[model samples]
Target chain A: MLSEFDLIKRYFTRERAGRASTVLGVGDDCALLAPTPGMQLAVSTDMLVEDRHFFAGADPRKLGHKCLAVNLSDLAAMGARPLAFTLALALPQADADWLAGFSEGLFALADEYGCELIGGDTTRGPLNICITVFGEIEPGHALRRDAARDGDDIWISGTLGDARLALAGYRNEAWLDAASHEQAGARMHTPTPRVALGRLLAEQKLARAALDISDGLIGDLSHILAASRVGATLDVDALPAGLALQREDQALRRRFTLAGGDDYELCFTAAPAQRAAIEDAGRASATPVTRVGRIEAAPGLRLVDAHGVPLALSLRGWDHFQQ
Target chain B: MLSEFDLIKRYFTRERAGRASTVLGVGDDCALLAPTPGMQLAVSTDMLVEDRHFFAGADPRKLGHKCLAVNLSDLAAMGARPLAFTLALALPQADADWLAGFSEGLFALADEYGCELIGGDTTRGPLNICITVFGEIEPGHALRRDAARDGDDIWISGTLGDARLALAGYRNEAWLDAASHEQAGARMHTPTPRVALGRLLAEQKLARAALDISDGLIGDLSHILAASRVGATLDVDALPAGLALQREDQALRRRFTLAGGDDYELCFTAAPAQRAAIEDAGRASATPVTRVGRIEAAPGLRLVDAHGVPLALSLRGWDHFQQ
Candidate 1:
C-alpha cells in the first residue's frame, strides 16, 4: 500500500489557481498565502463522516465534491470570494482508485470557483473529510446574520426540497420513479454553491443579511432571525420546489420545502427599496431569486399559507443528535 | 446529552487575544481575519485519530493539548508566529466533563501563545481531532526544508527520545521506574512546541532550513535532505537523549534517539558564519540549542560515532502503515 505521504502527493497535489494569493501550496509544513491588500480573511470549516453524513459505499468523487462544496457554501453565505482551502482527510486504507475519483471531483469544482487546495492532512482512520476554506472580502462587505432589519424582504435563490426528497427515497420514507430518483439523488450528492450570486449581492450591498441553507430553511432562517433580534414571516406558497415535488401531497411538499435540508441556496434579506437592485444583481449573475418571506418586528418566526393562515411544522430540521 | 452547537458554545468560545486582527470570530458562518500588513499567511493542518494517534481513554485534557501542539509544531517548523486556529472535532457522544477538560487544556496553551481558537466544527462521529492553524511571517523570513545548503551546521532544540521511551514502557518492550515513567509519559502526552525558538531564528535570519521532529529524527530529516538534495553526517554522540535514556543500553538508546517519534523539537540548519547569531537567538528565546551534525555536499545521510567511524543502523524510523 502507498504511504500517507505518497497518497497525498499523488492525488491531492495539483497546479494551484490564484497563484498571487497562494504563496505556498502543498508539500510544506504549512501553506503560505497572501490575501489581497485591504481585504479581510474569511475562514470556515466543515466535516463529513461516513454513515452519519454519507452512505458506506457512496461515490467517492461525489463525496469529495460535496465536502468542499459545503465549506464554500459557508463562504458564499458570508459573501466572501474564493481564495484557498485546506483539506484534512482520514481514510481506512490507501485506495488509489478511490482517491483518483475523489480528487477529480474536488478539483473540478475548486477549479470552477478558483479556490486552490492549499494544504491538508491524510491519516489512517475511519472515513472523515474535513475542509477549512479561506477567502477574502472587502472591509465591511461581508454579509452577516446580525445585519438584518425589520421590514427587509427575504429572498431565496434556486430550488429547495429536492435534496430532501432524494434523501427520503434512500430512507424508504417516500417513493419516487427512477427518473425522479436520479435527479433527486444528484441534488443530494452534489449541490452547487451559489458563489456568483452571493458575490454580486455582497459587492452591490443589496443584501442586508445572508446565509446558506444547510439545515433547512426554517431552522437556518431562525439563526438569522435570532442573530438580528427580529422575526420573519414566510409566504409558504412562494417557496420554490423542484420538479420532484410536483406529485407529492401538499403536506409532504410543505414539509420538504420548509424543513428539507442540504439545499445549498442562499437566503438573504434586503431593504424594500433595494428590490430593483436585487433583481438587477440576480440577472447579472444569472441566478434566479425568489422573494419568499419578510423580516418582521416580532420576535418569532411564522409561516403563512396563501390565504394568510399560519402553518405548523413539528420537525423543522434534522439536528444530528436531537432528532 | 448536549447538542453539538451547545457543546461548542459552552467549551470552545473564549475571548480572542488578537481581536484587532479578527473582524469576526466564532458564532458566524466564517471567521474573519485581518492579517498583518505585508505579511504572508502560514497555514498547517494535523489530525489525531483515536487508537491511531492516542489511547482510547487518554486524558482528554492532554489529548487536546497535543492536538493543537502538533499543528503549532508544524507552524514553528516554518518559523511562523501563530495567530489563530480552527478545530474540527468528532465525538461519539457529548460528555460535558470531557469537553471541559479538553477545552481547558487547549485554551491554556492557546493563551500562552496568543493563538486564538477562532472557530471550529463539532459533530457526531468517532473520536477525531483535527486542527488547522494560521500564522504570519515576513515574505522571505520563513524557514523552509528546500533551502538547506551544504556546510550548514545542523541544530536541534531541546531533548528527544523520552516520548518513545514512554511508549516502549507501555508496549512492554522496556522498563521504566515510576518517576521515569511519569516524566516520559508527560513528555509524550504534552509536548512543548518550539514556537519562541522558531520565531527568533526566522526573525534573526538564523536558520537556513527547519522542521519539527515529528515521525522521528531520521525519517523527518530524510524529508529535508530529499527536498534540499543534500546529505548530512550526524555525530550520534552529540544527539541529545532525554534523562530516561541514561540507563538504557547503547543500542536501545541509539535506536530511541534515531527512530523515536513524538518529540516536538525543532531540527534546524544554519550557515557556519551565523553560529554566534544562532547562539544569541537561542539565548533570547531561552531554548537550548545543540549542534548535532553538519550538512554535507553528498546526497546520503550517515551517523558517525565519537571515534569518527560510521554507524550502520538498520531501522530508519517508524512509518504509520509500514510498522
Candidate 2:
C-alpha cells in the first residue's frame, strides 16, 4: 500500500488545481478565497457515516456524490451560488478503486456546479465523510426560515416520495420493474442539487424563506413554520407524487410523501403576489415549482386533503438520534 | 433531554448568532457570512475521531478546543485573521454536561479570535469531530508552502515537543511541578494559534513558505521542502526545546524535538534579508521566532550536529495510518 503522503500526492493533488477566488489552493496551510464584493458566503456541513447513512457495500462514487449533494442542498436552501468546499474523509483502509471512484463523483459534481475542492484533511478511521460547502449570495438576500410570513405560499421542487420509496425496498430487484428499479436507484444515488433554481430565486428576490427537504417534507417544512412563528396548512392533493406511488393506495402514498427523506429538493415560501413570477421562473428553467402548502396564522403544522379534511400522521420523519 | 432542534437552538445557536460578520446564523439551513472588504477568506478543515485521534474519556472541553485550535493553526499558518467556523460532530449520545463544556471551550476561543461558530450539524454515531475554520487575509497575500526558495532561512515560532511530551506522561501530574504540569497540559489542550504573527508576516510579505507544525516540525517542514523543490539543513543545537526537555538527556530532547507532533507552532521560510524584519515583528508581537535551519539547493531533509555529523532516526514522525 502506498504511504499516506504518497497516496495524497498521487491521487488528491494530481488533479489540476482550479483557479479559486481564494489566493491559495492546495499545497498550502489553508486555502484562501476572495469572496465576491457585496456577497455573503453561505456555509453548511454534513457528515455521512457508514452503516448509519449508507450500507457497507454501497458504491463509493455514489457515497461521495451524495455527501457533497446534501451540503449543496443546504446551500440551495439559502439561495447561495456554489463556490467551494472542504472534505474530511476517514476510512478503515486505503482502497485505490474506492478513492478513484469517489474522487471522480465528487469532482464531477464540483465541476458542474463551479465549486472547487479547496482544502481538507484525511485520516484513518471508520468510514466517515464530512463535507463543508461554501457558497455566495448577495448581502441581506439569503433565504432564511424566519422570513416566512403568515400569508406566503410554500413551494417545493421536484416530486416527493421517490427517495423514501427507494429506501423501502421498492427499488430492489425482487420488487421493482427494470425501468422503475433503475430510476429509483438513480434517484437514491445521484440526486441533483437545486443550485440553479436557488440562484434564480435569489436573483429575482422571490423567496421569502427557503430550505431543502432532507428530512421528510412535513418534518422539515414544520421547521420553517416553527422558526417563522407561524403555522402551515399543506394541501395534500397538491404534492407531486412520483412513480413510486403509482401502485400504492392513497394511505400509503400520503405516508410516503409526508415521511420521505433524502429528496434534495428545494422547499421555499413566497409572498402571494410573487407566486406567479416564481412559477414562471421555474417554468422557464424547466424545474417544477409546486405550491404544496401555505403559511397560516397559528403555530403548528397541519395537512389538509382535497376536501379540506385534516390528514393525521402518527410519525414525522427521520431523526438521527431518535432511533 | 432536549430534542436535537432544541439542543441546537439553546446551546449552539445562542453564542455564535450575534457576531457582526454573521448575516444569518443558526435556525437557517445555512449560515450567511459577510466578509469585510479588502480581506480574503482562508479556509481549512481537520477531523478528529474516537480511538484514532483521542481517548473516549478525553475531556470534552479539551477536545472541542483542540479541534478548533488545530484548524485555527492552519489559518494562522496561512497568515489569516480568524473569522468563523462550521462544525460537524457525531456522537453516540448527547451528554448535557459534555456538550456544555465542549461548546464553552469552542466559543471561548472563538470569542477570543473574533470568530463565530456560524453553523454545524450534530448526529448520533461514534464520536467524530470535523471543524472547518474560515479566516480573512489581505487579498493576494496568504502564505503558502510552495514558495520557499533555495536560500531561504527556516524559522519556527515558539517552542516544540511540549505537546508530545505531555501526552507521554513525561509532564503529567506526578512527574512535574503544578505550574509546569498546567503549562504542559495547556499545550496539549488549548494550543494558541500563532495568528497575529502569521498576519504580520503576510502583511510584510516576509515569509516565502509557511505551515503549522502538527505532524512534528521535521515532518511538516519536509512538506515545505517537498513543495518548494528544495532541501533543508537544521542546526541541532538551535531547536527551541521547551520545559518538557529541561531535565531530559540531550539525545532524548533531540529526539523529542525531531519526532514529536501536536505542537501547534508556525514553521516558515524567509529570505536572509528578511530575518531582521521577522525578528522585529516577532519582538513587537511578543512571540519568539527562532532561526533553526536554512533551505538548501538539494531536495531532501538533513539534520547536522554542532560538528556537522548527521543524525539517524528509525522514524521521523507520527503517520496516521502506520500501525
Candidate 3:
C-alpha cells in the first residue's frame, strides 16, 4: 500500500515559483510567508464538497480550478492582489491520474494569477476541498461594502447568467446541442476571477463598494445595500447576459440574469462623475463593464422597466443550509 | 431554515480583542492581518472528518477543542505564536446546542492563546472541520527538522502513551477502571499543546530540530532524521509513560509509549551543552523535559534496552491514505 507521505511527495509537492512572499513552503509542520511590508494581508477560505457543489463525475480539472477560483474571487471582491493559498483536501482514495489533472488545472490558474500554493493537508475521507487564499491591499484603500454613497453608480464587470444558463442546460431544463452545452457548462465549471479589475479598483481608487456576484444579483446587492444603508434601482432591461442567454426567451433570460447565481464578476459602485474613468479601467483590464443601476436613498431594492415601473420578483438565489 | 449567513451572524460572529496584528476581522470577503516587522507568518492547516479522526458521537465541545488544538500544535512545532485561525466547517444539520458547545470550546482555547477566529466558510455536508492557522516567527530562528546534527540530545516534553491507553480502553483491549478511564480519556480528548516550550526553543536557540508527537515518537522522529540526513539511537528504557500506563504490563507500556499516538507533546533535538538552559526553560515554562536519546551519524534508527542490546520493530504509525 502506498502511504500518505508518498502520496503527498508525489502529487502535492512540486517546485514553487520562488515567490518572495513565500519564505518557507510545504514539508514542515507549518509553511512560512512574509507579507509585503506595510500592506495588510487579506485572507478567505471556501469549501466545496462532492454532490453538493458538483456532480459525482464532474471533471477533476474543472473542479480543482473552480475550488481555487472561487476563493480568488473573494480576494478580488476585496480588491487585493494574489499572494499565496493553502489547500486542505479530503479524498476517498488516492487516484494518481485524478490528482495529476487536478494539479494541472490548479497550478495553471495559480500561475496565471501569480498566487502560489504554499501549504495544505491531504487525508482520506469523502471528497472535499477547502482553499484558504491570501492577498494584500493597502490600509484603508479596500473597496468596502459600507463605503457606498447614495448617488454612486452601481456597475458590473463581464456578462452574467452564463453559468446559471449552463446549469439549467445540465439539469435538462433547457435545450442545447453538444457545443452549446459545453460552452455553458464551462462557465458553470470554470469561473475566471476578476483579479485585474479588482486591483485597478483599489489602485485607481475607483470603487466605493464592491463584491463578486456569487449568489444572484438581487441577494448579493442586498448585502451592499444593508451594509451601506442605502437602496438601489436596477434597470432590468440593461442587465447584461451571455449571448446565448440573451437569445433565449426574454423572461427566462431575465430570471437567469437577475436571480440565477454562480457568476464570478465584480459588481461595484462608483461616483457618477467617474463614468469615463470606469471606461478607462474596463479598457485597461480588458473586461467589459456595464452600468446596471444607481445607489439611492430609498430603503428597498426596485427593479425598474423601461417606463420606470418596478417589477415583482418571486425567485430566490441558492442559499447554503436551505434544505 | 437558518441561512448560512444567519448562522454565521448568530454563532461565528463576535467582537475581537483589538490585536495590532489583526487589521480586519470577520464579516467581509476576507480578513486582513498585519505581520510584525521582519517576522515571517507561519501557516498550517489540518482537517478532521467524522468517524475517521474521532468517534461519531464524540462530544462536540471536546471535538472543537481538539480540532483547534491539533492545528495549534503544528504552530507549536514551528515555535510560532499563533495570531489567528480560520475554521471551515461542514455540518449535516444545524444543531444549536452542538454549535454552542463547539464554539465555547473553540473560543476558550483561542482566547488562551490570543489566536482570534478571523474568517472561514460554512456549508451543509457530511461532518467535517478544517482549520488553517497563522502565526509569526523570526527569520533564521525557526526550529527546523533539517537542522538536527550528530550528537544532538533528543528530548521529549510531557508524558506519552496516556492517549494511546485511552484508545485501548475505548476499544476494550485494555482494562481501566472508571477513574483511570476518565484520566486517560482526557488525555486523548483534550491534549494540551506545548506552545510555550516551542517558543522558548526558538527564542533561546536551544532546539536544533522540533516537531509535535502526534504520530508516535518513532515515526515522527524518522521525519526529522530523513530531513536532516541523520539517524537516531533511542534509549527505550528512558521513554516516558504516564503514571497509569507505567503500572500496566511492561511490554504494553513500551508499545504504547513507542507506537501509540495522539500525544501533543514536543519531540525535539537540542545540543547537550544547552542542558542547563533546557532545565531553566523547563522550570520557567513549568513543563517537564526529558532526555530520551541522541542523534546518530548512521542512517537508521536503533533502539537499545537497559543493557544496550538493540530491539527490532516492524510496526509503523498511522497513515491517512494507505492503500
Q: If the candidates were sorted by their DockQ against the true structure, best first, what order would they fall in? A: 3, 1, 2
Which candidate comes out best when scored by lDDT?
1
- lDDT tens per residue, model 3, A1-323: 56888877887788877889998888888988888888989999998988888888788899889999999999998999999999999988888888888888898899899998888998888889999999999988788777889999999998888888888887889997777677777778999999999999988898999988888888888889999999999988788887668768889878988887889888899999899998999999998999999999999888987678888966676787874
What's the distance in Å from true for residue B18, model 3?
Answer: 1.8
DockQ of each: 0.79, 0.74, 0.81
Model 3 regions lying over 4 Å from their true place: none
Candidate 2: regions farther than 4 A off: A170-179, B15-17, B170-183
Q: For residues B1-323, could you state the per-residue lDDT of candidate 3 as single tens digits?
A: 67888888888888879999998788777898989988999999999998878889889899989999999999998999899999999988888888888998988998899999999889888888999999999988788778899999999998889999998998999999887788889989988888888899888898989988887888899999999999999988898897668778878878888878899889999999999998888878888999999999999889888678898866577678752
Q: Write the per-residue lDDT of candidate 2 for residues B1-323, one digit (tens) a residue.
A: 66677667666877444667788776678988888886888889999988767777888888878888898999889998888888888878878888898888888887788888888898877789999998888876778888899889999999887777676664342365566566766787778889889989998898979999998888898888888889999987788887765556687678768778889999999999998999998998788999988999898888988677887755476778774
Where model 1 places Cα greater than 4 Å from the true spot, the runs are: A16-18, B16-18
lDDT of 3 at A194: 92
- Can you write out model 1's per-residue Cα lDDT over B1-323, one digit (the tens) per residue? 77766788899987555467788888788999999989999999988999988999999999889999999999999999999999999998889999999998998888888889888888889999989999999999988989899999999898889999999999999989998898889889999999999998998888999999988999988888999999999988888888787667888888888889999999999999999988888898888899999999899999999788999987666666566
Give per-residue lDDT, candidate 1, residue B96.
Answer: 92
Model 2: which residue pairs collide?
Answer: A21-A34, A22-A32, A22-A33
Q: Kindly provide the TM-score obtained by chain B of candidate 2 when compared with the true chain B.
A: 0.94
lDDT of candidate 3 at residue A15, scale 0 to 100: 87
Measured with C-alpha atoms, the lDDT of residue A3 in candidate 1 is 79
